[model samples]
Target chain A: MSSDHSHLPSETELRAKALESLLVEKGLVKPEALDAIIETYQDKVGPRNGAHLVALAWTDAEFRQRLLADASAAAAEMGYFGRQGEHLKAVENTPEIHNLVVCTLCSCYPWTVLGLPPVWYKSAPYRSRAVSEPRSVLAEFGAELPEEVRIRVWDSTSEMRYLVVPMRPAGTEDWSVEQLQRLVTRNAMIGVEQALAPERLAP
Target chain B: MRGGHDLGGRQGFGPVNPEPESEEPIFHDEWERRVFALTMATGMLGQWNIDQSRHARERQHPVAYLEQSYYENWLAGTEKLLIETGLISEGELRSGAATEKCGKELRIPDAEAARKILTSGGPAAREIENPPRFAAGNEVIVKRRHTLRHTRAPDYAQGCRGLVREHHGAHIFPDANCDGEPVAHHLYSVEFPSRELWGGGAEPFDVLIDLWEPYLTLVDGNGE
Candidate 1:
């Protein structure tokens, strides 16, 4: 079935503005609501939430078990439940095995936890190749796992979103949750990079 | 439908040169934010389900589907759904005019509900009368052929043999969700060997997909 509105593809920004103005004029979508939604994701929700969960898992073992068992509920306990995160699954990276997340069909991410996905995560190259050649992808992201280590690529095909809990750095065993939170970066939780070691912290 | 949106195991895309996370902005420009907000807010109208909205995006011409940026597709899909659901029209879309107040009769969410809407996301899982057909540790084969309508079964895993790793109880069936009454089926996390999906030269690893019951069939004890 061909689209009659084929001409609408060009001038993306202009078209977006037209649509928004139409909706706002019709009293269907409030401009303030759009600003609120944008602000929520932009300021409040994002990688910091995932970092908090990772930091807690590192400092508290029982929370880690709960998180691994039922991520959605565990996340809700810390108030990290929302869109793209209803059925969240937390995957732990161990010395013997590594985990990476990708959505081949579309970008399905834990929006509430990790905020918006990075551009590469939604790009065609990463979507097409991540599942096929994860070692190369991981290497490009500066996460070079040993050849002996197994890789589990979780394709987010369904509603079940995944978050990789990167192995806690060795030297930070005694670090506080607040300090450990600083080491957990957004890319690390996506399995593209490992959590930063204590010495790597910024001066 | 081996829709063009299915990018798994496909080749020839260049390196994924990701921007350094320190500098990458969540929304590259203001329009992206508008598109996202508009899509999410429009989605709150309850005119269409998530599967339908996704189909709107995937059903576009392959060139449009692949060439457009992520948010561009979202805008395209939103426009398509808006027109298809009678919430808007091609004329209105073109003129940026609400002649009919097409959305006047609709139940639209306001600014106060943004937080509630994002946090209490639309959960797809449901309780159905039928019990799950497959269980953990069961060997299964993905059915090669199914309807051409919207489906979650990816092209790479079609007709391949795999093991049932886990069973997620009844959830909304995406394929059947294209039309008619809502239905739910058991969704299983099926694990296929990378070699099986790509080739023997593929990096040794496992690729797992969440497939509904209809997309799979049981394999014999002989591993046939």
Candidate 2:
């Protein structure tokens, strides 16, 4: 180590070193094992998994009821609930109003469903606008609620987590339950976008 | 920059903010490093070019190369870790057999896993726990608590009077001073006038908060 450690390592490097040193001190496991475990879990239990579950729940009423009532347990039934997702809750959207979730402090999200969060969820524009100017944020996602309709923005903290269950769209009367289910994207359930209609995907 | 999880009513970027804290070591080792090194090692070999490619559509500017370089340096460090840890063999890294898992399923897809996770405990069992001292329609006040840790109960709501409308289940307590156990706490649907929380010309009926039970004290008729 040079005396002119003035060119100190970047925050990223310092954090990584700190974590590595902590793990070494704890003797919990090797860095390699931790890396491999993270890789495996992140790969297996990322956001796409949650999207699929939302798609299924959208198509099933009984399951949706179970989910809204007990999100953590319901998520576990699909293998999406674990250490990170133990404190999950799903706030549903309705035709009358919409719900959009944001992490005002840090990006504390239900990683089990929505993988590594998109850069925007952790951005200043989102954290600020989602609370003060929520209507505009919703507009960015093409979800414009009526002026009279209330917009509830759930700010997730460390303990309580939130998920938005979007409303079912119209014009899918003839579509099979399975076909209608495909229209539910991760953004839709997050209240950013309304569920896509069957025609929206038509050629 | 606030912590990655602390952005409330702030603005910048398009819903994306990098935590000022150092990158999570695990992520640095895996993706950031892998992508950067692969780009650079190939650049040095003369088989790949950097300047001309820097002006690609995604870059939208020539300066992106600098950003990429910074990212590349971080990536190389993680790759070195991978090699040291035997996560990938030297031959594999050289032969392009060192596959980096991106957008790949780990075991089961997250979407599929979500279904099971959400449905695991039946509906009856998932409700928020009842606070030892309160119930629905009970008049209570938000307790004033502060510390240096992740806290779910907001400070503004402290000392505010409201009715306990619902009971959300027990969760991992974020108050750093607590025992770290998953304690039982009720989630209340506390109603405050927009005037009450905002303190100026707030809507008389515009009141809302899904507060935890611990953030409250019973309010007497005097509005204390």
Candidate 3:
């Protein structure tokens, strides 16, 4: 019964508040459950989960073989299989090919491993231009591949979500999983950029 | 439907300027989180599937679809689903009050229960005894037909020729799922050269899209 409407929230906020209140009042939705759902995505699930798998693949050759062979089963090993990530297909970025993922129809992303998608991933520009001008798109993200390397753009038009396994950086052979994980950014898994270079992580 | 959401290869969008991964916030604002949670929680009621929820948002006008923020689109879709499914009346939404009880029994999950369900994740992949229509490496053409309803087939890929990269097994047909009918069909990752989709001058790249069987046909040598 907090009736402090003095702040004058926006229409969107007011509507959201009203909808939440109505659902709670009708006993159709639990506020605690709603908080739990938000907290789960916000805190628990994220690109770090994908990063962990990436780091493992970089370090362990057997795990990398399993991951490339069957991504969903491999992800299940790390307990990262659910929701949008039910049918994940990892596309490895070798020296000859670069992979990029985009959901042109909508922002259909692998929420289980990568959490919620970024604003740019869901934006119209990325969706429209990713397939048509992938080289330019990659360049925009500061990832410039040479002309000889072929680019493969995965358009997520169905239930399948693509996870780009970025090429392991050079001079990181001795780095621990913890240190390697720190170098992995969310964009790297999405193929917008490569993993943080060893020199870049000096700070 | 050739809605604004079908944005692949078509131009005019400026650039893909992404925020640094470290600085990005999970929810841009409090309302976005609430709308997202509301969509998930209400979605758990089993009134509709994920495709139906997407169709609700797709049903919006092209301009409105482009203009609204991501969560705003979610709210719009949630509002539409609430009314369409008889979970809430339009009057209740406008007045910010529940006028009558929902006719159907709605079970609300507690925090722990919700977490378990979410973590478990309902997968749409179905097992079918029938053999797939097309195999990997087969060149196929996307069927060129527009239905005025929910369909996962992107307009950009329609009527375009592509090679089937792999058969992804049977999956819930989104068109049928959106229409409240659960049907399974063979899904394949079809790879079309960038030139085939956007013509010459485009980079030498292959755009791979997962297309269901119904939306594709065998490409005869005569180019029919």
Which runs in model 1 stand beyond 4 Å of their true positions?
A: A1-10, B221-224
Docking class of predicted structure 1? medium
lDDT of 2 by residue, B93-186 (tens): 4543324332212232133333333334212113343434666777877777655433555554566676665555443333422323344454
lDDT values for all models: 0.86, 0.50, 0.88
Ranking by TM-score: 3, 1, 2
Whose TM-score is higher: candidate 1's or candidate 3's?
A: 3
Task: Superpose all Cα atoms of candidate 2 onto the true structure and report the RMSD in Å to 1 decimal.
Answer: 13.3
Best by DockQ: 3
Clashes of 1: 1
Tell me the number of clashing residue pairs for each predicted model: 1, 59, 0
Among incorrect, acceptable, medium and high, the docking class of model 2 is: incorrect
Q: Write the per-residue lDDT of candidate 3 for residues B54-87, one digit (tens) a residue.
A: 9999999988888777788889999999999998
Prediction 1 global C-alpha lDDT: 0.86
- Worst 10 contiguous positions by lDDT, candidate 2 chain B: B48-57
Query: What does the lDDT come to for candidate 2?
Result: 0.50
Please give the TM-score of chain B in predicted model 2.
0.42
